[model samples]
Target: MLQIIQRKRMNLTLPRNLHDSLLKHAVFLSVCLPETVRDTFLVDPAVILIVVGVVMFFITFCGCIGALRENIRLLKTVKFSFNTLLFAFLSLMLPQTRSALEKFARKAIVHYRDDLDLQNLMDYIQKEFKCCGWNSYTDWSWNLYFNCTRENPSTERCAVPYSCCTPVPGETVINTMCGFGVQTQKYLDANKSIYPVGCADRAVMWIETHLLLVGALTLGLALPQVRKPRHTCRVCMGGRTSRRHQKGLTACWRSRAPTE
Candidate 1:
């Protein structure tokens, strides 16, 4: 009777613990995998901005030094070093679900208007980049206030943003109404009235015009560290230091140690 009771207790306890352990393991796998992959590959917009800034600084420093010295060897070295990165960027394929730049711009504007920061960013980009809407002034047609539809009774109908207009000479205050009703006009008339060309076209033209200059700048950046070196990369991955660079660090520490 005593042996029978002991055996029954053991059987019940083992299954209960095993069931709990399996449940925990299942939860861990489900919660962690997708988050880990997302964080590893697709970075946040703010992080992207920071990375771009750092690269620009690096390019300027390398280009200035190499150009001032007129060092052919250094320039050639940098050019060869950056060839892989340049190729990667040029070959990068981003998703184009919307299929057209005009449609994409309209979708972005309408979808993100409620997000104040995004709205301000779009306005600033248009003003500072000397650009209007995405594909052209007509892209504002997607906006509720600017849609050309007569059935819509908004006061801002058939209008584009003021940033689309050319500024007057010595103008201190901006004329906010300059681009109002410009969208209703034909391209030939609007060309004289306001900026008729789309921001997308402007951006494309800029890229095409400066493609060679961009290539030269990219090569002049001299970031040969971007190469596939396991030791150096590991150091860079964690706060820009590694064991390989720890030489003399130990010496400094020893020198600081108490001595007789």
Candidate 2:
């Protein structure tokens, strides 16, 4: 009889322990998987860039509205949101900056093909030197074009003789003209300051910066705020306490009162 009782108790304890373990495992699995998936989605460069750009644009828009209305609260919110968006935008641009540097370096090498000495020097460095503790260009992009030479012989000299020239390829020239024209229209629509520079490279940079800033500010202002239950409860209690005090409630009674 004692053996039968002991066996039953052991069986009961095992299941309860197993149940507790499974519950804990389930909780871990639920939280960990979703977070991992979320991180995976967020790590994409295009997604991050778009998200930050949209946030910044909204915040800037709100800031403009606040300024026009002379609302202090709105202005403060706008300022905070703008700063946050700016930080995010900068973070997203880090990867793009690296990509741009790599692209530029590759283009430079192609453009300076006639300079065998420079090519040989680059090849030697690439083969022998490990930059940022990496054997290949996989680790660093900006370092690849560090102290590189510019294409133009004179700073004052214009590369293109005309708006449309053989020096610039037809497709590239068309794309530049179209992009600038579209951006010029956008500036006009917004009544914003338009840069006088007509050079393709300068114009492209300007447009990119403007677009990125606008997008980041916009999304920051529009993103929904996360609500914390504990915070909400505290706020409710605070208001109730203030109200009670206004009605001449004693400190002792308030201290002894149970929280709802």
Candidate 3:
């Protein structure tokens, strides 16, 4: 009876082609899974940071050696410098690092904004982060404006509306309504609805910090190169002149010395 039952079960087993088809379908479904699931489950910011740091380290190391060796070739030096700056900037400005910095800034902004004391808030930020002036307040004000006004805008999209400064709020209102500006108040309204105040603040902070760092690094690295003129052989300096005159050049003994 047991043998008979086993034989019946074996007979009901799926054919090889059917089994393979089912497996292929399963794999197809797996392959088409949402990207977010993979991002959420497999992505590691720390690993990315480490990889970027390593690349930057290598570039800086190579650049230092090339510079020390006095490799006067502009192409080599420029290439090295560019790679060094790119990798270094990546290490500092990666999305994860920016997000962390933004989170800190957002928390600070929210805590202070909630107090409704702009002066105190500015003072606190100035003391803590060494950031001062009306720009900071204006940024917060814009943040509030966008947050209060928008409906379901993306954080990335909200910045567009805040970048412009119209003489009157009505102008801004009109501009937004007409979609005349890079960012409209409608977008801002949308972003505000979708995200919390803290998220916007954080995103802004990240962008500001990373941009400042990138600007500083770019200036620091590029200014010296720009200020210094490239050294070249006399022949190279003459450029087209050398090419044109090459066939007509007299031998040193054939040319007479100039009279004083």
TM-score of each: 0.50, 0.22, 0.27
Q: Highest lDDT: give the candidate number.
A: 1
lDDT of 1 by residue, 53-96 (tens): 88766666667778768677657756764785577655652344
lDDT of 3 by residue, 59-99 (tens): 67667776667555644866977877779778866747756
Leading candidate by TM-score: 1
Pick by TM-score: 1 or 2, better one: 1
Q: The CA-based lDDT of model 1 is what?
A: 0.65
Cα lDDT of model 2 by residue, 1-260, tens digit: 99999998887775777787777657644542332334334333456578979977877877888876868887899878767757866887665865655453444333222344434444443323211112221111112122122422222122111121112245543332221222213323312222223223443455687997889888787664343434445455556456654344344446545789
Question: Local distance difference test, per candidate?
Answer: 0.65, 0.43, 0.45
User: Model 2, clash count?
Assistant: 21
